[model samples]
Target: MSTLVVRRAPITRVLRSELRMVLRRPRTLIGLGLLALVPVLMGIGIAIATANGEEGGAEGLAALVIGNGMLLPIFALSIAMAMLLPLTGAMLAADALAGESAHGTLRGMLMAPVGRGRLLAVKAFGVASVTLIAVLLMALTGIISGVLLLGGDGMLTASGTSLPFLDALGRVLITALYVTLQVWALAAVALAVSAFTEHPLIVVVVSLGLVIVSGVLAAIPALDWLDPVLVTTSWDAVSEVVRDPIEWGPLVEGGLRALCYLVIGGSIAYSRMLTRDG
Candidate 1:
């Protein structure tokens, strides 16, 4: 009688593998490299333009050049949040399942001991991890660049109040986490679209298209009420958190809105992955 050793793949192991693969890709490296440049370029340009914060726009440019180390990340986030972060999320997630299917490897993934739902959960987590890292890197780069060029001594609140360095750092972190939630939800929707197609390009295009459509519609007066519900409308939720007193309403609603989409998108992807032969 031969006793067989059974090897079970834990979700953590799966997640690790996914992360390793994602990070090793040349495209990922290049994208992150370019993203890291955004803050550096912005910092340099602002420093030169404002004469290193000695000229005009002092009040307006304080966070960016106000010589506040803690506020540097927040300023960087403001630049990227409008488009780069969202596009980064869509690109990172667009290939999760679709690329596998397009290359005929998805069937092999399904054949693994891991369940389809668990596999997708793992993929989503992996992509979210990368997206989160990207956000941090952007902020980190900003902090470094700002300190080198402008300085980071006097942290200021939107209300013109001074903040301790530690307090400002804390708020910057909170904002990064808030941005992470946004990407995580967006990843799920992109993954769902990926499940139905074998083209990763289609997955990315459609995911972004949905955002553009919702954003445009939300801007219209006739659809003002829908702003609260549109997937793209909560991008500014973090702005509320950095202020003094810290209003939590928009933050909570933004998180829940993302959670709702995560459920719907993950469910759709799971069901489709299970039923589809290829």
Candidate 2:
């Protein structure tokens, strides 16, 4: 008598297939398209405001981006981190597992020769790819539109000094990377929630609900003690990048907080996947 051995698929092959599936989805394309357009619309609106002698009427980041195109990506990233990027992360994470489970495809994957851990890794890769792509798309569009509408100029630092183009560009890239990490943390939590339910909507709702609750908790002065534990509390640190001296304390703190969430969420999802029926 002989035992049969099933061959496991290569990781690259699995990851490639997963990415193709994710990138080809209509919803994915549509979501990314919308994300890309946001920065363009923002540039147009800023241009219009400036043309109307309303440049001084703008406030905060908007006021800074009035003529400095290099700041546009940073401005767009700030807005996205508040809500849009997190929402995208939740939706992609939900579709990664819950949507597949609802459509009966997850069982097939579970029964395959692939280990559950590897399956989770592949799903994560796909989700991360979508999230990263979404961010990059926004950044690219912001750059193009800002340069066209606002004029290519050095970024104005919070200290009222101007940075060289290369330096400003580097800062924008760093901001993008930092924002991506925050969204990844949220996606990890959504993945954990997705592991327990076949309803994609539940994953999105739960993930976003957590975000909203965190923001609200962080805003309350009495909850100062809780600020250390809330993810949203550290988000304001993103502005530190554009500061003249570049305050590293808050940025480092925020990155570490995000990593904690990533580890916790990934661990929970792995544990549930190990014991789940499919």
Provide the clashing-pair count of each candidate structure.
6, 0
TM-score of each candidate structure, all chains considered together: 0.91, 0.96
lDDT of 1 by residue, 127-186 (tens): 888998998898788778877876756567776677776777778788888887887787
Model 2, position 244, has a per-residue lDDT of 89
Report the lDDT tens digits of candidate 2 across residue range 91-152.
99999999999999999989876789999999999999889889988888988888899985
Give the winner by lDDT: 2
Cα lDDT computed for each candidate against the true fold: 0.78, 0.90
User: Model 2: how far is 44 from its true place, Å?
Assistant: 0.1
- The residue ranges of model 2 lying beyond 4 angstroms of the native Cα positions read 1-5
CA lDDT for candidate 1: 0.78
